[model samples]
Target: MKILFATSEAHPLIKTGGLADVSGSLPSALAHYKHKVRLVLPAYRAVMERLPEKSLKQVAKLSVGGCGREFEAVIWQLKAGAVPGVDVPVWLVDIPALFDRPGNPYLAEDGADWWDNGERFGVFSKVVAELAMDRAGLQWQPDVVHVNDWQTGLVSALLSVETQRPKTVFTVHNMAYPGNFPHSLFAQLQLPESLWNLDGVEFWGHFSMLKAGLICSDWVTTVSPTYAKEICYPEYAYGFEGVLQKRAAEGRLIGILNGIDEHIWNPEVDELIHSRYSAEKGRVAGKQRNKAFLIEELALLNGLSETRIQGHLADWLQAPLIGFVGRLVEQKGIDLVLEVLPELIEQTPANFVFVGSGHKSFENALRDLAQRYPERMWVYIGYSETLAHQVEAGADMFLMPSRFEPCGLNQMYSLAYGTPPIVHHTGGLADTVVNATDENMLAGTATGFVFYDPSRFALKSTLLHALGLFAKKRSWQKLQKTGMQQAFGWKASAQRYLALYVED
Candidate 1:
């Protein structure tokens, strides 16, 4: 099958969140299965810097939204060697006016999202839709146009306008971030007024790219099975429950758990960390070395004494190194984690390492907590790919107490690296992490801990439970082996996606 993946971000080039990871990994996974896959992403400044000079090929100029604004798009062919036998062609939509700039792709200097995000992504979607219709002129055509999140949601909307359209698959990585714009901006999108209706792009009197994709796409899928069910409820729906429920009633909505790229996550082969270890040979010693290295690094960075560092590691090692790697925002349950920290520290000798940046209030709170308990806590206020891998591999336990996780990759990575995850039983977390129970004799099959409620008490109690189990070396080792053995590969996911594309 010839597949075209339209996304706002892709990894190893430009990334902001999990969407980029998916966009980068999934196509490569599909290509490995011998499917002809092509990816389209905006050529941001970062992408330009990273791309090889020769890989870029000049593609035709694209005119979007009837705005008479032409942008020159370059096609960068990602060969088998580029992604290791994942022969996928990656086309970058280069338009300096919209995508070319400094800093993060989504945020401005003041940390506010670019106000023109709606228009920016809308233009990219229109270009993709246009490209799909022109087979003879283009390098490759698509049987399936897979659009990710709200950024490329408008592609499905645009496809609906054409009679000869390819099968469309819309994957909702997260529904919280709908591409909504004022009703007046409809004219700027150059969409027909007929599309701005209850059954079309209209969402609460606003033009919603997400709504349009949900309504018009051939199939709708979320990241995980539990998330698929959760989105149909009022609390988790983010105002789209009715639409999702309606789609499910029509048998068009489904869920497929996401998989991480194991090639990039293998601890034994990864060069980014201080030490390397495999689950079979070096699990214990490698983890100890990693713990020591982390402690030394943190102490050096923060100018703490050797005694302070030793105390921190002792606390960290007594139970297990429970780690959190993500944005420090309310959605991630940072506030809940903070509220439960003191109780957790008192109940268990677990050390905490947080690596991420978001929300000024949350960042300050984490910083203050790190200062107060420097011996038991470490915080890094930035995103680092290498550091994230170290956290996944080195930590005995990974924490993702998110209020909602559309399709978390870190949890999967943790499983791969023999680090059991303790996550809130919601969305993708519930779908992926099997809650340990006596009935299941979960010792050898358990991957991580899970809590039901999104509260401080629930989180703290769950951590305590995990710490108790960690005290038992045999049980903990069994849990680690079970997690490492679990398969969350993309082959099954890709097959499910192929089925969705073929569905009527």
Candidate 2:
């Protein structure tokens, strides 16, 4: 089958989150199965700069119409994987006026959303629709067009009106940001007037791109089985509960769990960490060396006072090293981590390292708390890809206390790296991480620590439990090896998607 994967961002060229990771990995997985797949995304300035002059080949030049004007764009193709055997063909929609920006694809320099995002993505979607309809002069058409998130939502709606069009699949990564605009902007974009009613893109006097995707597409999917069910209720749906409920009733809604890119995340051949080790060999000593190097590399103990600094390096290496990597925000439950860290630090010998950036309040609070317990805590305010890999490989335990997650990749990364994760029981976290209850532990099926309640007390209690277990060498290694042996690769996921595409 020929498939067109349309997304707003992809890894290596550009990335802001897990969407890029999926966009880059899934297409390669599909191509490995001998299916022709072309991944499409907008050509932001950063993306253009990331590509080599030799790699990009201009495929077509066309005039795209949107927001009351004719915008010129060029379609260019490039191969998108650094690994030897995995190469994905990528198409870039290059429109200077709309996509030639420096920092974020959707944000301005002052941290506000770009004012013309409605027109920008609408024009991009127009180009995508043309390509899917075989009108872009490429002489190649896909049997299926898979669109993701609100950025490419309009493609499904645009293709719905055509008498001869490919099947459309719209996957929602998150339900919080629903690309909504004023009703007046709909006329400005010159969209078909027939689509302005309740059954189409209309949502309570606004033009909603997300609604169009959900209502117009033939099939709808989300990241995980649990999130698929969560979005049908008022708490997680954000306002589209009725639409998803209907889609579910008609058997058009699916919940496919996401898989990680094993090529990039595996510990055996990864070049970023201090020592490379597999779950089968040198797992213990290799982790010890990496943890010691990471602690020294980040100066995790430099903040300690004279008396605290006197501990031997071997002692610090023996203590548990906990890791947190992701945005510091309320949704990630960073506030809960902050609330309980003081008590944890005062009562235990465990050390902590936080890596990532987000809301100002959360950043400031993390900084202040690190200052109070310089010996026990270390913090990095921004993201570093190398540091992320090191944390996954070096830390004895990883923390991902999200209040809700569509599908999380870091916990999977942690599992693959032999680091058991401590997570809240929600969304993909519930689907992926089996709790370390006595029954599961006896069965040798426990992979991580899971807390049921969404509060600081639960997190603290869970952390203490994990710390206690860490002292039991036999039990802890059982959990680590069990997690490492699980399969979280994309081959099975791609097959499931192929089934969706060819099914009657």
Candidate 3:
């Protein structure tokens, strides 16, 4: 099947969150299965900066919207052989007025999303719809036009208006970020009012890109099975639960858990960390060296004594390194983690390392904890890809105490790196991390720890239990090995998507 994935961000070229990773990885995975998978993304300034001079291939110049202005779209093709056998073609839609002027793709230096974001991505969606209509003279028409998040959500709606339509699949990475604009922007989008009705684009007297995709797409999918179910409820829905519930009633809404690219996450091959290790040969010694290096790095940054180093290492090994790597936002339960920090430090000997930036309150709280407990806590107040790898490698346990997780890649990456995760029982966290119990036995299939309640006490108690279990080196090793051995690749996910594309 020929598939066209329309997303706002993709990895290696551009990234902000897990969406980029999926945008970059999934297409390549599908391409490996011999599916002609192509990606369409905005050619923002950052994207142009990263593109090689030779990679730019001019496709065509076309007029969009009623403004009658012609925009030049140069296609930047990212071939599969760049990443070993993974060959997928990435098409960059370059329109300077819409995308070139940017600090971040979505935000300005003032830390606000561009006011014209609705117009910008609306043009992108229109471009993608035209590409699908003509197939750009390719041998095959796209079997599925998979749209991600709200940025490209209008692609489904635009395709719905087309005469030659491909089956559309809309994947909501997060429901919180609804792409809403005034109804007046509808005309600027070149869309007719026929689409602005209860069963169409209208959302609470506003035009919502997400709502258009959800209502018009043939199938609606979220990142995880648990998140798919949660978004149909009032609490997690973010005001779109009614629409999702209606879709569910009509049997159009579905869920498929996300998987990570294990090739990039393999500890044995990754060169960013202090030591390289795998589950088979260098598990114990490699982990010990990694822990020692982490302690040394933390000590150098915060001034810790040798005694503190020994204590930290002993604690890390005695318990487990429950790691947290993501934005410090309320959705991630950063506040809950803060509330439990003092008690967690007192009760558990686990070493914690947090790597992310967001929410001033959580950042300040984490920094304060690092200052107070310099030995046990290490906090990096920004995103770092290299440091993230080290955390996945050095830590024995990965922590994702999120209130709602769409489809967390860090936990998947941690598991791939032989680190068992302890996550909140919500969304993708609930789908991926299974609770350690006698009935499941885990024997050789356990990946991580999971907790149900979204409270400080529950999080603290779960951490304690994970740490207590870590003292049993045999069980800990077994869990780590099990997690490492499990396959969470994109092949199955791609096949599931293929089925969704062909679904009538």
lDDT of each: 0.81, 0.89, 0.81
Across residues 1-504, which tens digit of lDDT does each residue of candidate 1 receive?
889899988777678999888887888888877888888888888878866777666666655553445555544444445534234777777777888887677887778898778778887887888778773267666888999888888889888888877889899999888888887777766787778889899989898988988988989998999889988998888798889999999999999998877778877887877788887888878877887776677655666887766765654555467789999998899999999897776766778889999998999998998888777778888999878987887778888999889878888888888888989988888877876666444434567888989988888888888888888898888788777878787888978887677777
Candidate 2 residue-wise lDDT, 469-491, digit = tens: 99999999999999999999998
TM-score of 2: 0.97
Stretches off by above 4 angstroms in model 1 are: 66-87, 306-319
Error of 1 at 339 (Å): 0.9
Which regions of candidate 2 fall more than 4 Å away from where they truly are? 80-86, 300-312
Clash tally, candidates in order? 1, 0, 3
TM values, all candidates: 0.94, 0.97, 0.94
Shift of residue 334 alpha carbon in model 3, Å: 1.0
Model 2 error, position 65 (Å)? 1.5
If both were scored by lDDT, which would come out higher, candidate 1 or candidate 2?
2
